[model samples]
Target chain A: MNWTLMWDSLPRLLAALPLTLQLVALALAFGAVLAFATALLRLSGNRVAVALTSAYTFVFRGTPLLVQIFLIYYGLSQIDLIRDSFLWPVLSQPMWCAILALALNTGAYTSEILRGAIETVPQEQVEAARACGMSRVRLFRRIVLPVAIRQMLPAYGNEVILMVKASSLASTITMMEITGVARRMIAQTFAVFEIFIVAGILYLLINFVATRLIKHAEWRTTPYLRARA
Target chain B: MLDLLDSGLTSGLHGWGPQLLSGTAMTIAVALSSFLLGLAFGAAGAAAKLSDSLVLRGLAELYTTAVRGVPELLVIYLLFFGGSGMIMAVAGIFGYGGLIELNAFSIGVAAVGLISGAYSTEVIRGAVKSVPYGQIEAARACGMGRWRILRRVLVPQTLRFALPGLGNVWQLTLKDTALISVTALAEIMRVAHTAAGSTRQSFLFYSVAALLYLALTTVSTTAFQQAERYASRGVRRA
Candidate 1:
């Protein structure tokens, strides 16, 4: 109802947008690589790889991201080795810690998504590719990977938005992202509703745009399924 | 000593175990209260969405979409701050001018209930739609009233279909309870946070927190699977 305060809070919240975006982008990039490897590891015949990846996913997915962030940020600092080692420079920064936790957490969830998607890729296509003397890597690259990616997009899109929301947890560690700035402003102005509503709108906008981009990608990738114009 | 610490031994947990366990209980209580409340909201919302009234459908759509689209933390903050005032204002209409306090536990349950309700709404709606229309029609033909039909023909099938989706929502509801630590509720996350700050064993306590959450999810997932089996007993599946 405080229209003026809500309007005034918008710019400050907007200023935090880049940090939020950066957390999402970096975490997703790292998480994508981690997820792909995890998915492949589960598919791999090697027992060690499968066990390790499953445990990785289990631990990360089992816990809350906020717990992970605190453990990485405040927790890791308690260790003398991490503080003394070369890792300290990066781990000491709260932003990096947040990014690390977010990436690991998202990685676990996405790996499951990717694994399920890849498994849904029809066995006949892979069989046909193998029968044609296509190498394993080539068969996966030309056939399985493409099909899986297409199927994975919708779920991955959900993961992306979830990551964006997860990024708000980063604010707890003093990242000053959208939610962080809003909390700070609220403390200053006592306009908790105004600031939070503005911040929530900012998050909704990000997710809205993300959902559209994913939907567009889905449409583009599934050309064979499309109706005539 | 370093090896023991590196392995995150229970040495650090010597005194904090009881506190964390109590906090876990609080978290469970809150999660359960919120999950029950959410189920109610979800059922009502699904009914509204399935109703013939356009306005009811629109309002239900708005509730689910808006809550799902926004971050849970923001909604918690919004409710926790604005909620008490709203309650007090309503109470004013009843001739109560005295200051009344709603505890953090209730606020947390109500707020998280609303968030989880949005998710459960989608799941319940899908489950309701999945129920065969012919079955309902057959029930009506048998001279069954609406309530009887719902109780007999609809509820069981919906439960069977909705269990898996509701399992996912339950996991969500459980995790969202962690966010309520931002309030004054002495839940698991807040306890770990406080213990970490005091004991400076952030790694140990948080690892415990993570372990505790993992245990909760694991147990509930198993329970849901059992319930799913029980619900679908004697039913055919592909």
Candidate 2:
């Protein structure tokens, strides 16, 4: 391993970190909203809502995110209608395309996670809340959402880490994320192992910090589970 | 759209039917080989992780954490490029160094397998833990040797417990094969990509690719559900 080369390449890769983090933040924020909507749709007791949500999850989760990225980035732009539409400008940019694909992809997986957590919320607690004449919104806010969020955090943490990794695929769409920058460096220097290793370490560092933050969140949320000692 | 579909299917003039079919076949082959390789690695890693030796456990832990933490794409790139150098060095040791190379297919299998194996290690280890300890003790008391105990008591239950998680890993492996397109393997995604670029019918080709992947995932999911049912036969459920 060429330590010097790897060390020198760190700054260039780090330069791309903001874009990478932006992608993750935007995708996750959008995806969480979409996921909540989808999950609620599935539980809404309406057949159309259930079917629509099911189809959305099935299509999005069933295919690879890379294909989805390609489809949005390259495929959608092929249509004249889409090209002429008001959304064309946003869709035309690779950055937005990548974010759209990542958001939609995570939305599918996150919906499932949220759905499972919501369904697994204690039925008795919900029943008691309802019996106490709590409004639907209040019941959801006071009981269901909090418990579900707690239950979902660990899995959601995995999704966040996955989004971080998935953001790397943005590189394929001409987005100069860390992986993209590393690939460019490799083209110029041909130090494939060193460049990639440095890139890998950067990812590992992000994940490591993310993991700790999630654990801290978990500890904060689950005070009742703490030991007396 | 109808005309595009017609052209996609026809034998001449933008015909990509045969190409897509072959690509799908390649996708299956790669996923199967990678899944098998992953199972082998998972078994070894799980064994190491579960072993009494601290060194073995530490090594296994490092393997799983590193693979899980890193992006699969980076892993593929590392293996694709770094792998050739390592292969050449090994060849050099054998006194045959004539620009040795590792093909894309082998590299794809190895890379995907390594990623899948890291995940499977956790699954298998969890499944093994789920197998009741008393059953193994009973087998030992019944004069069953180590191999006999493993076969009769441990392996069967572990497999039953691991089947669902293994099925998930299988799906992940299949999807991951798409990334191998970067290495220029003409799998489903790559074929669709080439066809889309050549035909300038990106929507048509990519939609076809997405549909194909959806079909694969749906069929495999059903097959796994059936396998799970079969595996759980004669067992009581709450």
Candidate 3:
């Protein structure tokens, strides 16, 4: 291993770190909101709502993110109608295209994770809340949301890490994220292994921190387990 | 508009569609072969991890931990760049002094196989652990040899529990094939990518590719679910 080369490249790679963080952070935040809405609709009693959310999740999760990004960036642009449309501003940039794809894709998976957590929130508790005359809104806000979000924390953390890794795919579409920078460095230095190694270590470090945070959250939530520990 | 769409489809099919078809073939072949390779490694790793020997146990643990800890894309990249050199080095030791020519298919298969093997190791290890020790002891008392005991008492039970996890690994392997585009393998993603770039119609090609993958996932999921049903038929579900 070229320790000197690795150390030297770290500074340049770190410079590109902000965009990578922005991509993952913004996508996850936006995706989380979309996911919550989608999951709620998916669980709703309304047939139309359920059907729409189901189709959305199915289509998004069914496809690879790379395909979706390309479609948004290149495919949709071919149409004169779309090019002239209000959406053109958003679709014009590769960053937006990448974010759109990542958000939509993660939104689908996140909805499923949130849905499972909500479903596992036990029916009896909801019944008890209802018996106390809590309104539906209050019931969901005070009872359902907290439990579901807490349950979702660990899985969502994994999704967050997966998104960080998946963000590398954005490089395919001309976005200069971490993997993009790494590729450029490789192209210049002709050191594919060394550049990728540094990039991989960066990813591993980010994921390691995320995992520890998730574990800490898990510990805090499950006080009973913490007490035993 | 519908007629336009129809004509567009026809034009695409007549143009670069054959490349996409061939890519799909490559994807399936790579996924299948890598999956089989993964199964072999998974079984061995599982056996080693479950074994009493510390050496075998340590080897299995390291294999699972290192591979799983690293990103899949990194693994694929590492194999793509490092695999050739390693193969050539081994060939050199074997006295074959020639250029090492590895096809894209082999590289794709090997990379995905390594990734699948890591996940499969965990799944198969869990499956092996789920097998009842009492059954193994019973087979031993019946004067069955180690191989016979494993064949009769262990393998069947392991498959039953391993099916669901293996199914997940299969879906993962299927999606991971998309990463092979880096190698210029002309898999569905690559074909769609080139078509998108040339036509400047990214949506059409990508949508088609995405649908193709979804179709693959759906069909495979159905097959695995059927296998799961079959496997659990004799045994009662919780």
Candidate 4:
């Protein structure tokens, strides 16, 4: 335990915090939106919609995140059509490619979490909304969605923490996120242990804060638990 | 694009299929060897944790919590770099090392084994706890030896209870082996990456790799499900 080396490495690691946060926050936000839609699609009575979402989740979750990241970044780049297409604007940048892959991967898992939450919602509530002459939109907004969101938060928190860890894979694609920066620093300083320790500590800190936020949200949602707290 | 895919698939079979086949074999070997090693560590660690002694419980807790909290990729990375150094240091103490190379296979095995042990520790601990104390006590009342009680009364039940969680750990260990590509091990992911780079058919190669992973997971999952059924035979279900 070299105190001096650790202290020296902290500031350097801190500099990479922005990129790390960017990858995590952007991916989570975008992934959340996609997940909401994917979850609904999964639950839709339409067989095609159900099949499409199922296939998406199956492929993403079955393969390694590292493989997905590589395939999206390096693999897509190899396509002549994609290179020539209008989508190339988004596909050309490694940052966008990484965010895309992370979002897609997280979306699959998040949708699963959300789907379970949705299913757990009481059937009577939807029936009551219908009896009260609520429109489908109102019924979902006033009843179904809120209940699902509350139940989904804890699992979503786990997904969020997972995404934070998963974002480290983006570093492999030349995205200079936290792990990427640490890798570069190690190459320069040859301080593998020092740099990785610093980077790992950084990840621990972020996750610690995220865990607290999730707990806070959990408490807020469970009003009965609030009294206990 | 469909025609292109057909052509690519045919060419891939002719050109790269052997590498993929070998990669699959390597993947299975890594997963199986690691799972066996993990079972050994898990059983000991779980037993230690379950012991009445404070020192044993603390040691077990430390191993599980520390390893579990850290990212698996970081653990693999640490082992990749430090493993050789540690081996060399041990060899130096024994007075022999012009360069003791712990080959890629050993490194992969050990790294995956180490990760597997961490998860297995928790799974085994949980399974052991699920076993009722009265059974062990009854064995003792019957004048059964400690070894006899463990082998006859404990091990069988723990295996049955631990199988599902161990199945999950097996899946994790399999996927984590994909990360060993960073160490330049030519497992499935690495071969896909190399083929992707060389052929510039990134999508085709990666999709194939993904399918291979899915195939592995599907087959292994079925096997585990079957084993679970076999293990639970004659047991009452809730």
Q: Considering every candidate listed, which one attains the maximal DockQ?
A: 2
> Candidate 1, after superposition: displacement of residue B226 in Å?
0.6
lDDT of 1 by residue, B1-238 (tens): 2553555464647578788999999999999999999999999999999999999999999899888887888788777777787788899999888887789999999999999999999999999999999999999999999899999989989999999999999999999999999997999999999988887778888888998999999999999999999989979888
* Fraction of native A-B contacts kept, per candidate: 0.72, 0.81, 0.56, 0.49
Question: lDDT per residue, candidate 1, A1-229, as tens digits?
Answer: 7899998888889999999999999999999999999999999979999999999998898777888898899888988888899999999999899999999999999999999999999999999999999998999899999999999998999999899888988878888999888878877887877787788778889999999999999999999998889
Query: Candidate 4 — which residues are off by over 4 angstroms?
Result: A124-135, A226-229, B12-14, B53-56, B91-98
Candidate lDDT (C-alpha), each? 0.90, 0.93, 0.84, 0.84
Best-to-worst ranking by DockQ:
2, 1, 3, 4
Judged by TM-score relative to the true structure, which candidate is superior, 1 or 4?
1
Report residue A191 deviation for candidate 3 (angstroms): 3.0
Predicted candidate 4 versus true structure: per-residue lDDT over B60-172, tens digit per residue? 88777556555667666666766787788888999977687777778888878887897899899999889899999999999999999989989899999999999989988
- What's the lDDT for residue B126 in model 1? 99
Candidate 3: the clashing residue pairs are A74-B202, A75-B201, A75-B202, A75-B203
- Weakest 10 consecutive residues of candidate 1 chain B by summed lDDT: B1-10
Give me the runs in candidate 2 sitting further than 4 Å from their true place.
B1-13
Enumerate clash totals for all models, in the order shown.
Answer: 0, 0, 4, 0
Model 3, A72-140: lDDT tens digits are 777777778878999999888899889988999899999999999999998999999999999999999
**Lowest summed lDDT over 10 consecutive residues: which window, candidate 1 chain A?**
A192-201
lDDT of 4: 0.84
Looking at model 4 chain B, which ten-residue stretch has the lowest summed lDDT? B65-74
Q: By TM-score, how accurate is candidate 4?
A: 0.91
Better-scoring candidate (DockQ), 2 or 3: 2
Name model 1 segments beyond 4 Å from true: B1-12
RMSD (CA, angstroms), candidate 1: 1.6
